[model samples]
Every structure is written in C-alpha cells, then in structure tokens.
Target: DAGVTQSPTHLIKTRGQQVTLRCSPKSGHDTVSWYQQALGQGPQFIFQYYEEEERQRGNFPDRFSGHQFPNYSSELNVNALLLGDSALYLCASSPQRGWDNEQFFGPGTRLTVL
Candidate 1:
C-alpha cells in the first residue's frame, strides 16, 4: 500500500514556460484533485479528475488542465506559466464512493517561476 505521491518535489522555470506535474493516488482511492497554494495562502482548488474525466474546475484560466488515468493516477498541466503561477502544487486523493470518503494529500510539488 502507498500514500499519494507527487513527482519532482521541486521545479524552476521561466515565464511562458510549461510544466507538468504528476500524482499517484493512494491505494483504494479513485478520485484526484489538484490545488495551488501560494505563499502564506491556503490551498485553492484548481480542478478535480475522476474516471479519466474532469469533474470540477475552479476559477483558474484555461492554462490549467489535468488528466486522470484508469489506475487512478493523475497529472496536472499548466501552459504559458507566469510568475504568479509559482506555488506549491498539491495532489489530494479520495475514494469517489459513498459518504465518509476522506481525502489524503501528498507532499506538494513546489514550482518557482522567474
């Protein structure tokens, strides 16, 4: 059994660059959500994916996108990145089932844009 895992732990890029972050869900989890947390701010919902389809999205621009695999893994993609996009990208997983599903978060991937 494994907890949620995210790739690259950290990343650095320049403005206008593109970045892709990956996430592997915890065992028994079926839904994955992506969040962005800027310095000193709480995590803001970016979007959520389930069953390979986007289920919900936040007020972010079209540059944000995501994909969920049949194995419950997911990826978060951001295009035309801006300095304002620099933040900790978190991946959370929960069972897309009946009530009482608890979400578990992974160590976030820190993005630094110059």
Candidate 2:
C-alpha cells in the first residue's frame, strides 16, 4: 500500500505570500493531521481532520488551515506567511476508527520564508 506522500519536497516564499502543500494518506486510513517542525524542534500538532471535518486543532494561528478529502488525502494552506513559518510541514495519517493510533509522517515539505 502507498504510504503518506507530500509534494514540492521544498518550498521558498516571501514573508507575505501564501502557499499550499499537499498530502496523500496511507491506504486504509481516514484521519489526517498536520504538524509544523521548526529547526531543531519537535513536531508541533497544527490540526487534525476526520470524516472530512476538523476534529481537533492545536496552538497554531488562523493562518494555518487544512482540508481532508473523502479519499483521505489532505492539504495544508498557510497564508500571509512569515519567516517564522519556515519549517518542515509534516502530514501524518492514522486509521480513525482504531484505538490510540500512531501517525505515520511524510518526509515533509520544507518551507522557507524570506
């Protein structure tokens, strides 16, 4: 089965522009979560989507939003980006109906804002 995949492997943007990153979840999974990892920092949960609806959100700002499709794939959008937004944007997937499932992470789409 195909594992999680992310696009553009790397990205560079200005401080005020917007960027959209994509993710395809592993086969048979229904939950998608987005995380942000700054340089030398652990991944920080951004939000999670299940049943095509956002179920939980972390301590990120409104600029960070996401969407999940019926097929379980997902996209994360960051608007009005900042230099601080430069980090590895990781997408994780889990089977929603299962117990405290561990998330499988993508290699991540690194974003650098100048």
Candidate 3:
C-alpha cells in the first residue's frame, strides 16, 4: 500500500568519495529502477532490477551500480564521485517492466558534490 521511498532528502559529498542511496519500493511491486536528473533535465535511466537481479542497464559507467533485495527494496551506489555527479537521484517502482505498469517515484535524493 506504501509508495516508493528514498533516504537522505539531501546529501553533500566531495570528489572521489562514494555515496549510497536507498529505496523502498511500493507494496506488491517487484521492479525498481534508478535515474539521475540534472538541473532542468528529465531523468536519465541508470539501471533497473527485477526478481533480485539486474535485468537492464543504461549507458552509465561501471561506477554506478545497484542491488535489489528479495523484498523489492533497492540501493543505488555511486563510486569515485565527481562534481558533475551532483543531481537528483530518483527511484521508481512498478509491478514489473515490459508491462509498463504504473510506476511511482520517490521524492528523490539531491546530491551536491564539491
């Protein structure tokens, strides 16, 4: 019955550091995807997970990774962060992909890199 949730509404980090963002998907949902939204831009797909496995990945570098738990919760990890990495990290969830079921988005974790 709950919708997607993300931790740390705002975060500040320095270059070369690593940050981990968390997400709890909506109830009864089994798919979660991460996105990066820069200022004034729509989100760019980072990757997606289903059935506790990564099923699809975007054009992002290996520094970006994610994990999905059996419970449908997920985590987004960014390593060796750069100032350019600063953006809004959004987590979305749906019953599953391919079906294009309704997806709910989190409030997003805003990151600022120095």
What TM-score would every model get versus the actual structure?
0.96, 0.97, 0.95
Itemize residue pairs with steric clashes in candidate 1.
none
Candidate 3, residue 87: Cα displacement in angstroms equals 0.3
Where does candidate 1 stray beyond 4 Å? none
Better candidate number, 1 or 3, judged by lDDT:
1
Worst 10 residues of 3 by lDDT: 95-104
C-alpha lDDT score of every prediction, in listed order: 0.94, 0.92, 0.92
Residue lDDT tens for model 1, 1-114: 889999989999999999999999999889999999999999999999988999999999999998988899999999999999999999999988863766899999999999
The digit string of per-residue lDDT tens for model 3 on 1-114 reads 668999989999999999999999888778999999999999999999998889999999999999988788999999999989999999999886455666789999999999
- Every model's Cα RMSD, please? 0.9, 0.8, 1.2
Q: Comparing candidate 1 with candidate 2, which one achieves the higher lDDT?
A: 1
**What TM-score quantifies how close candidate 2 is to the native fold?**
0.97
lDDT at 26, model 3: 84
